[model samples]
Target: MGRREIPLDPSAGPVQQLAHALRELRAKAGGPTYRAMAGRSVFSASSLAHAASGRALPSLPLALAYVEACGGDRQEWEARWEAAGRELARSPRDDDGADPPYRGLVCFGQADRELFFGRDDLVDRVVDLMGRRRFVALVGASGSGKSSLLRAGILPALRERPEGAPRLAAVRVTTPGGRHTSEHAARLTTVPAASTEDVLLVVDQFEEVFTLCPERDRFLDLLLTALDEHSRLRVVIAVRADFLGRCAQHPGLAAALRDATVVVGAMSAAELREAVVKPAANAGLIVERALTARIVEETVQEPGGLPLMSHALLETWRRRRGRALTEEMYEAAGGIRGAVATTAEDLFRRLTPSQAGTARRILLRLITPGEGTEDTRRPTDRAELDAASPETAAVLEQLVRARLLTLDGCRVDLAHEALISAWPRYRAWIDQERERLRLHRRLTDDARTWVEHDRDPDTLYRGSRLAAAADAFAGEARQALSSPEAAFLDAGTAARDHESRQTARAARRLRSLTIALSVLLFVALSASLLAWNQGRSSGPRPRFARSGPCLFPPRPTSPVKTALPGP
Candidate 1:
């Protein structure tokens, strides 16, 4: 659809004036869409609109995005967006409840070392590995500092180098649907297939290529092959640790990771402390030692430890007004979950009810398993959404604008796991919907089979009944499996062998004791019988007989006693 052509008037307020000017600029630039404008600017179209409308203040990043899109002076817009952002920061929106401080990757304070600590060694290692092997995979659990380190540490560090150019070409392909993959390839093709010097090409959240990708997908393989084959390009992939196993299932990926792989684990205690404490101090927020210690203690050993946890702490700290961050506040925040929950709730609370419903549906669909495989954690594309409902296109756009869903080409996925796990109601809704979809598919399959085979009336009747039952079962299955609670049940398997070894050992000991006890009892009973017999012999044999046997009784007593004596 064409954009609304609003006439620009000179006499308007600052907010209205900005919007009017932006519209005029778009028209003058051959009827450019927001995407067209946003493509040129550092700010997204939605962010630009929000900023210009005065609904939210513009950020330097947003201004940069907007300016770049409009073909306007980037330096000028940057200064403007920065000024507006500071003003917007002072005035909280009505929907802004006690929300966490994580706005997005752009809003995050990565330039400040305090706000972006840890991963010093890893960053160096990756850069070094790239220099040596021309490729490196930063593999880690979700919430690991892969993205953060790359952006905050590596990118910034590269920019700081005296020899580094002002603009070092870096492309982060987040959403790579099949169609988009071709476009991405085309973009890469334009870069003049690397020379002797390596070009750094980073694929962030590389798992998305698999998670959201369709079956028999060659996009990832092709991209990897291209990078590997190219002599001048250094490819760095940030993939989820869990998905690393899935990647390994492919021979190409297995070989790549083996040659150049660095699995990012939880930061050490010292690192965790630095990550938490430093950022707060830089933001003009005091992080108490006790509070930092508690955060580190609770978070240090956890997978992907301090990144999300640190953000949660900072977010909670921001909401506390002037109060020093305390242990009670930390506990109440649910640590990582609390931070994520707060952020999601803030974002969700800002959305319309309809928007929330669409987001929920998308999440459920994403989590549901296909016939042979599981749904991706990454965002779904139009085709994938069409399998669920017709409104997917509209819903997806709405979600993307809301920042709940990310888009790379046509594919979509949840922004983070906290959104799914944060609210119990949302979690329940997803579970229920997934169950329904599962059941529907099963019923459809059974019905199709029955329709193809039916002949006799009796057979037809039976087939129809069976089909109906299948349908019912499918629905129940969808509802049952959709919920996290049911998922937990499914995941609740017997403990690992190592975990159960102690119990097994105890059982073995009990079995051995039981056998020993039984043997002892048999021996005791035998001894008792033997002792009784011996005592009877020692006491002498008592003989009783009738009158006719009286004569024989005396002989018998003598004979019996003699026989007993022998025994």
Candidate 2:
């Protein structure tokens, strides 16, 4: 049998290098076609072909399968994969730091503990509240380091536990969102406490219960019940401060807020300085004194402005001429007010027009309704986007890793709602479609109600309401509607069109009746006039004045029965 030839790009970076190595293994096996390999292996033939295509790196499963099929050493291939990952991570970005010191839009994780600063007092207060109370609510403005404090500060502090202090056992962190509030609450209540000393349930983004989940009160009720049922479980919830009024509506949470609510506000000037100065110092970079003073002076009045400061620092670091941060770099990043928008807009403009359009759509999709009925961040699945287009897929990954969009598991979301209003481009996009989105939101709510009522059809949008939704459902917003909403709108539209046709038929019948009535009246008037004319001409002229028609005349009574007398 003849051997099939496959070309390789030798100097095309680590990805191509890995592809070359894979092809060599195949060549050693007499270069079997992808079809033959798929027949033997579990991986698909197209997947196998793409793995060796020298375009991008293959996933571990595909790579491992290829290595095994070609009989390469597993240990060696795994090591190569690790090396590729390292090289890819270190690959220089357009901004020059793929792993920048500052995180933009994304919250700091445990791994980013060192990078998280400025919330020392807030964290301590929360820790104190948690120490004294069984239930503690950490409420803060969005982008005010609520998640960072919980993950980086409180959790770590609890783990340290002052040695032999109730010995931390099982700790689970979850968000109450998207059809999982009950399940998440269940995790807290149904903990395996026998194996552990105490269970810690850290619920981050607790506001999601109200914003994303429908049975919010039910979930809250269940949570209160769980607290009563479980002794070892200590719960800590982090909710955005904007939703405090929403929290008050839930009696259990409102009662909990009677004492245990910890409000996190903007960090003081000194703290903001530490936040900016320390992270760079740890990263072995220095900020100019003038820059620090300028930042602190400008940021003092701006409440909940830590994100702006951090993002500006990140972009400034990217534009750093050397070890020292400069004034020009900060300006180029659009300064404090414009840093996030500037960077985001820059990323957007750099994309091809089509890809740029796709990016807009992806960002808009991340926006779900907020507690205050404003647009807020919603985690969307990455698979919802078409990965078939390599360009679109690449942009999705880029935006996410850039921290402009936050990705967790297979899901993705805007890191914060602040981005919606902070960025001019995003703000304009939202403003342009505000009316449409409003209608879409109403439709979504009504449709959900309809389903909750077992598709009761009355909740469906009809007439102008359906028309409005359909009109707004154009372009990208069209795809944003849930399946139920789209179905409701469709059914409503059909119903409205049918009603319109029936109305048109009724109008046509009324027009015909009106025309017949007018014709009968005209015929009656003509007959009456003819009878009077005959009487005036056949009978005497009443011996009146010589006029074409007698104005006033007397009739001869004796000649009234002329026909009868003749008979």
Candidate 3:
């Protein structure tokens, strides 16, 4: 018998399916060309065509939109699209550090162990600086690994405290307004109040003191002073670069930090390979050289420079469904946001239908009423959560486990902005909520003002009603006002102080004017009395003048004398 051959259909691949779907959608769009749809969708026609032409698969959202435009079943198209996406995502990239929370998994080669790599000179410099100056400040942008380097590298090195060394301690001040310095002092004084020169105080996330808790500034200032006064204590602070401007606004802090600052940028290609790739290889993942190069190239791309890029890559690897990661897989994942969203969505999809709804409600409530930011204020009370059904609590627990959200103490927040920005559905919910919040804020402000200003029973009654309406809104606003929001609170306090000073000055001036007017009245009365006395002494008084001028008069006598003389 002749060999039997199975022919593969050209359109069977994801790219072909995407292209076919696009063509069908375009035809149904009643649009002659890609340009027409582009006008409607805000994406270039050529890009859309490329996405649908089987050369590349369309993003899930775009595919859904195209299917809807074509009068196709969106649910059906979405299922197909997701299936295709997963298939394409099976290919793994050959990078050593294909893990979450890092960048350029393959940039650094094999010699780059976590214990040693591109940081030799920098570490030595840091050590030298520490020897020379007890206080050293490390400054970098968020996700630049300032915290990583300090805790992972320097602190570990210092823990041994060489045979003759004094004590060394590391404390992470995560809470902005929380008691940090006292905590530090307490930690230091636990054993004994020893010589001042015996300890190293490493303060991590120092920017939170300014950004999340300005109330802590005085405490931090005192901490800084204590560090300076105590000869034995060495101080090291790590802060985000963005907050440097804020720090500068504080002349005292900016000056203190000016002498010691370090900026972290993307690692060199070699360093990246060492930091990322080699470690993964040690973990037994077989990474291809080409994939490593591709990852490096993508990691260096604009907006892809974040360490979070590594997190996406790692997640993509984990979601490969036991398949190898390839270039096609990478493209199907829709870059970093898509990868993040896909992972989150996968986790979310695992929940029962009811649980999913509960999760959605929790997110909806947590989001700003209108503006779009991932971080929301922690819910003030269980009533806030009770506002959601009991199912929400269960869903929230699930979300925390999924790493989509973080639960710190009683507060819950999205893990990272990338997660929010990655998912269209999530972003949309946040937008709608933000708008709701904005309107609520406006109403709340109006109602609160009415209540504050009127202070009348009737007005208070009306204002209270409005305020009750505003309560939901105020609660949302409070939720929106979180870690970063606290930075603005300082500005608000300054403005309030200025207004109070102006009002007090006005009151003082009014009081002085009233006193001056009273003194002038007293002087005028005394002068009038003196003038009356003088007049009485200088001239003949009326007969009734013994008491005061009265009816009896000397005029009559003068008149009679003149008449007699004339006669």
lDDT of 2 by residue, 1-567 (tens): 323446777675777888888898888988787888887779988888888887777888899888888778889999998777545433323444345678766777777878777777776777766666677888888867788788977777667674423344777888877656676677566657466566777888887787678677767776565256446677889988778888897677888777988877777889878888888888788989999999998777666676777777777776664477767677767778888887787688789888887887677666664535556677765654554568768899878766688778877878766687778888888777666656655675687677778877676777666777778886666666656667777778887888889999999999999999899989999999999998889975545666577676776667555455554
In terms of lDDT, the poorest run of 10 residues in model 2 is 89-98
Query: Looking at model 1, which ten-residue stretch has the lowest summed lDDT?
Result: 487-496
lDDT digits (tens) for residues 306-336 of candidate 1: 4457546655564343435655455544566
Write one digit per residue (lDDT tens) for candidate 3, span 494-517. 445676799899999999999998
TM-score of 1: 0.51
Could you tell me the TM-score of candidate 2? 0.66
Could you report the Cα RMSD, in angstroms, for every candidate shown? 21.0, 14.8, 15.8
lDDT ranking, high to low: 2, 1, 3
* True-vs-predicted CA distance for residue 356, candidate 3, Å: 5.1
Over 4 Å off in model 3, which ranges? Answer: 1-124, 160-197, 320-334, 348-390, 407-413, 420-567
Report clashes for each candidate as comma-separated counts: 24, 0, 38
Kindly give the stretch of ten consecutive residues in candidate 3 with the minimal lDDT sum.
103-112
